[model samples]
Target: MESWLYILCICLILGAAIGFMAGLLGIGGGLIAVPALLHILPQVGVSAEKIPHVAIATSLAAIILTSLSSARAHHKRANIPWPLFKSMLPGFVLGALCSGYISEMIAAKSLQQIFAVFVILMAAQMAFPFKAQSNRDMPSAAHLFIAATVIAVIAALMGIGGGVLLVPFLTWCGLQMRFAVGFSAATGLLIALFGSIGYTLAGWDAAGLPDWTLGYIYLPALVGIVSTSMLMAPIGAKAATTLPTAKLKKIFALFLTLVGLKLVFA
Candidate 1:
């Protein structure tokens, strides 16, 4: 088979697996794809050094579609917190827009290394769940706004869809685990939409990038991953509704730790 065909098949499989994990964990599939693409993308003609940026940008673009599908599926079950969504959207948009410019100035590997550390911390958070000790009420609008801004910045910098920060922050703010996961998934859609556009626009001046590469966006990987993830995300979301996410989240965190370590070394 042609190398391109092999790349497509791998992307499809990775998309499905990542989508399932995203649905189960309330994260954008980018957490998985970013590291995988750091390796896979270089084999398909992208520069080794540029692979991290491409992987992150492509993963973010793919998450826009995956999060939309996952959020819509979960929304039907009355899981989303619409008020929180309203409070966070503005900050999310602003954070996402700023991330692109930030990416241009900072080294891509630096961002990846930082993300590796963040993911390690998040893994520990998921496993131990420190928020379990907090005696807090539902977050206020101001708290949510502040948290949303911070999450948006991190999400944009890491190229995640926002749930990585949103879920934990919501939990710390006193939301139940299930509700936090569901609501964060919904918020991630908006974050990814704005962030993806911003990153693409901001990276337009990057040198030696491929054709059809708008900013840092890799069109081929984006299309392949989104196509499969959109089809599979609903299935994963449905499973989440029926299964135990806490246990799955712990397992997922372990997987994240492994991937995060690889990103650091890559």
Candidate 2:
């Protein structure tokens, strides 16, 4: 097959898979897309050294679209917490701005390594079913502020949608998994919106970026990913409602473990 054709096909498949997984996992889709893009982008002409930054930036950009779609769908289900959303936005904005600057300073490989370790740890935590929930009776405004701060810090540092932290935190705050997932998707949308803007503006002065690139994001990848992920994520969300999540958690953990090792050694 021609290289362009092959790349096109792979990009489409990745978009569908990431979208589906995002809906199923209530993640920002960055965790999956970043790692996969790191592997795939080089073949499509991006320099290997820049692939990780591009992956992270583009994943964030794509999430803006995918998360909006996912959140809207979940909104119809009445799963998002509007009060909490209001409380968190301010912190998210600050964190995103700071993180974008930090991202521009870091090497792509370093970011990938850091993210891999974080994923492995988070996966391990998820696999174990902690059975502990955070206290929620406290003032809603206070907790929302705290949660948003934590999310912004993590999202910027980890270069992931805030969903990974938000979902678990919300679940710990006593929301059911389904509601937590939906709300987290909504939060992810917010993070993406602010984070992408921050990264783009911060990296505006960055040099040697490609034609399809904006700051750190690669436009082609964003379009390919967002379009397909939006269409397919609901499928994953539907399956998540009916599936044995514990088993899926175990599998996802194993996958992350392997990917972490591969990234570390590569």
lDDT top scorer:
1
Go through the candidates in order and give each one's C-alpha lDDT: 0.76, 0.74
Candidate 1, lDDT over the whole model:
0.76
For residues 72-99, write the lDDT of model 1, one tens digit per residue.
7678987887777777777888888777
Worst 10 residues of 1 by lDDT: 126-135
Candidate 2 residue runs with Cα over 4 Å from true position: 1-8, 24-28, 44-49, 134-136, 139-147, 171-182, 238-245
lDDT of 2: 0.74
lDDT of 2 at 142: 68
What TM-score would each prediction reach against the true structure? Answer: 0.83, 0.84
lDDT of 2 by residue, 1-266 (tens): 75445655777889999888766865557778878888887776666556776777777888777667667888999987676667777877777766777776778778778888887777777677554455565347767787687787667566577766776677777777777778777877777777887778776766655666787777777777777887897798899999986688788878988888788778
Superposed Cα deviation of residue 60, candidate 1 (Å): 1.1
